[model samples]
Target: MNTQLMPSVSVEDITRAHLRLKGIVLDSPLQYSHRLSEIYGANIYLKREDLQEVRSYKIRGAYNNMSLLSDAQRAQGVVCASAGNHSQGMALACAKMGVRGTIFMPSVTPQQKVKKAKAFGKEFVEVVLVGDTYDDAYAEAIKAAETNGWTFVHPFDDLNTIAGQGTVGLEIYSAANFPIHKVVMAIGGGGLSAGVGSFFKALSPETEIIGVEPKGAPSMYESLRAGKIVNLEKIDSFVDGAAVRQVGKINFPIVQEVVKEVILVPEGQVCATMLDLYNEDGIVAEPAGCLSVAALAKLGDIRGQNIVCVIGGGNNDIARTSEIQERALLWAGLKHYFIVEFPQRAGALRDFLHVLGPDDDITHFEYTKKHNRAVGPALVGIQLSDPATYDDTMKRMAESGFKTRAINKDSTLFEMFI
Candidate 1:
């Protein structure tokens, strides 16, 4: 592997990509996040592709790939599968080009994403909701393509699509005349990385392109190290947008050539990042959308580097904000749930409440006594705004003579007891 022989990551390619996608995609804002920059010792510039028309960097790839289609192929229409972004990208591109399209999404996808996919198509494409995971939908899309004679438009893993995604690098380099030392982004199918990394590699060869993935779903991370696409047996769908079983074929090659480092973020950390974006910046960032910001907590230190973190997408379904917040608490170790063993006496519950710290609030409480009401246990959830407060709260509970068992990270018992 001669690092110098193949110029997959180069400036010329990135510049060409910028020229290619100039009028097609928005420049997307590159703004400084004061709060984040202060927290993580670095010059943090958030590439807000989340504000793009389709609320993601996906449009760049979809449009680039679809635009290269011959007139005859465009008439034949294109088909693709995505949990959200890519579908919307194809929809918008298809509508603009008057090319009919069929998009397949997993059944578990949120209603908001489905709606966005619909709006992006604007009558130029047909949305087909299918399967339970991105892999399932991708498989279904491939199957349907054969019967309908539609060209399967992969979300990543295509040359033109990579070129389209490369546009981001083009915009960033042009907008920031100064050198950017580092770039970080979330990788799903890897098209965004392939394209963006390729461009950055060419333009700013010294700039590092870091890809972040949820620890629960490390398909791309594993694939990159393995030097080929690899499959994960399981992935937590909490970050539903980016949880993928395998990396894209075409996307992997580009990543191998251009990516500098890959980082894995905990799902809970992603949740915390989302909340930070919302509470501090007044921006609602979905779990996958918060990947780059999530990097600040994991990337050891970078005091002086000019860094850019891509806010990949912002299609946050308002309905799930509460759950996101809850997850954030658990991840931050500020919330704990306990199943207390106590005698079912009059002062039992009262005594427990008195032990809670001043800032601790009872978020959830449930109890059940066996056939005998005189003795049993109760399951309680304590939500502390600050994790530091838990120690005092526990010390008080022990002093008050209350015996309890904690189960915060145990998913199995959490579902059954709390």
Candidate 2:
């Protein structure tokens, strides 16, 4: 709890980092979001770091850290661990800086991310697939660096990386034409939040800095509440980029000092935000990228104030779209999965179909045991035109002598059947 134990990162450092990043990383746009503004009742601006060179703001930190490496360090090479974004940034930094680099990624990392990191580094970086979690891969990367005498480029812990990530705040301040009331961003290892929060606190003292985390992986939020760093035993990796088990040691203190509030949003809400951005504004954002905007719904009123939401990355895999839509629909209450026990008679399905309202539609149906003679359970997924109709339809189905068990509330069974 002693702030004196940790070295402070000044606004000067972030300013210098911003200067260092010029012509190297993209000075991403701070554009007004009409759709979001209308939905949230605020003058909403999106800091589009998703459009950065590596499709993330990570390159700013990775490049800054690599650029500052000593000649001997550069010659010795660099190593890092990441699930996706950071690896791509490091690989591209190494390629551009002409330094050899090795990246350790989780074995479960998406194939698209692995391929992009490889393509970015070309011959300069080597990708090593390691254990199942980012923390597992991080430990392996640290060991690899120690064994090879390579300079390890931490994803978020180092002061230089935090300062580099802080450049985002600098750009946001410089680009915003109106007075900014609040800034919102997603937190993983806390590097981006630490950096941006520090810079904004020093420069725009009145602006509130809000940090958001996925509810399933609320390391920073819980840590701040506990007055110390807290490591989670399990995390939901759906928001892979921000699903960190623990916040960075070096960055946590900065977050505690500068960030005013930390909010947690459900993964389903993040998915819904991603879908909205893509469908409404033609913006493609990964789950973590949607976290900032997703928190807007939780904020009560911002009618006259100006708010900035940092869209952190856009490295989403096309293959995850169906799952994302599924989660979004579930969050919106438009979709429900049920296990229905049907009688052995010929009119069983017909009776069940009659229970559905005119707007109710079956999206999925499968007999769990069609060969069973007496009675069999059917896995049925239904979509409602209006979410409000769900309760009424369920009540009608129950009254009609149909036996049904809702699996949507049971995550284990929901995942298994739906």
Candidate 3:
């Protein structure tokens, strides 16, 4: 338990970073959500840090670290690897600072991200897609750092990096005329939470800090429970930006002391928030960015406290937008898929189709031929305006002498295959 590694970053460092970043970064919105305030029983403020220059708060840290580079180091350039937002941040920062930078990213990264990264870097930086995952890309970045002697700009877990991210805390405190009673954020690699938590601890120690994570990627929460950073054997990568297998060595201790709770929100719940923020607030929130706001649905009671939620990043893959919408619909009970096990004898498909009203439509249909025939399973996905239609549909199904079971049902187990 060496506390030396986690030396608390001061509010002074954060304020200084904010001052330095003034002309470089835009002041992202701090919108007051009256609807949210009434619903959550707290005076909620959405610190729209996602609206920053690179469309993420990552730029604050990237710029801070880059600014610290000596004139000599700037000549040689900076290098690091990121999934997307950090690359965007580093690319734009280096370009603006008149420094050369190289970024390595996941090979599976969407073409849009690649295009945007290249757009940000322009001629000032080089973008490379190296490996299937961040860990792989990072290894290559480290090698590049060693060989070229470039200043390796880590996305997190560095003194300069953490100090840079603390600018958010400075912004929060500066924007708050009233003392903030609570603050919430989504934690991925822990840099944002570390920097923000440390700054708040120094400046507003009484404010309760909460961190949220996708339930499928609750690495931080699980690790905190175990009292150490441990690798998860499996992780769901739906929330690609915030899904992490282990906590950062540098950030874990910093957060543990300051954060009051770590909430593991359901993936479906996150999608719901994404849609709500978009539909109600007209805020385009990526999965990772909507996490803290998503926690409001689960947090049943909070009467009159001023709360701030850091909307992290907005580097969403435009192509995945449909899937995000679908997930939201499924979570809202407006979409469902079921495997109807029926006799393979006659016009069963037509009969099932006729049972539905005009509003219900079949979204997917798959029938697997049997080699060792007993019966057949027809995988069907249905979309409807009303979820209650399922009950009536099932009731009619039973009376028609046909059996139906939801793919998600215990006996069906069809959803598990995918």
Candidate maximizing TM-score: 2
Top lDDT: which candidate number? 2
Each prediction's Cα lDDT score? 0.82, 0.91, 0.81
Model 1 gets an lDDT of 0.82
**Residue 11 CA displacement from its true place in model 1, Å:** 5.9
Worst 10 residues of 2 by lDDT: 367-376
Regarding TM-score, does 1 or 2 come out ahead? Answer: 2
Clashes of each: 7, 0, 0
Candidate 1 lDDT tens digits, 153-262: 88876777777788887778778866798888998878777777877766578999999999999998898788777999888877877889998776777788888878
lDDT string, candidate 3, 50-114, tens digits: 78867788889899988888998999889988877778889988889888999998887766667
lDDT (10s digit) by residue, model 2, range 25-89: 88999999988888777899999998987999999889888878999999999999997999999
Rank by lDDT, highest first.
2, 1, 3
The window of 10 residues in a row where model 3 has the poorest summed lDDT is: 409-418
TM-score to true structure, per model: 0.93, 0.97, 0.90
TM-score of 3: 0.90
Question: Which candidate model has the greater lDDT, 1 or 3?
Answer: 1
Q: Give the C-alpha miss distance for residue 42 in model 1, angstroms.
A: 2.5
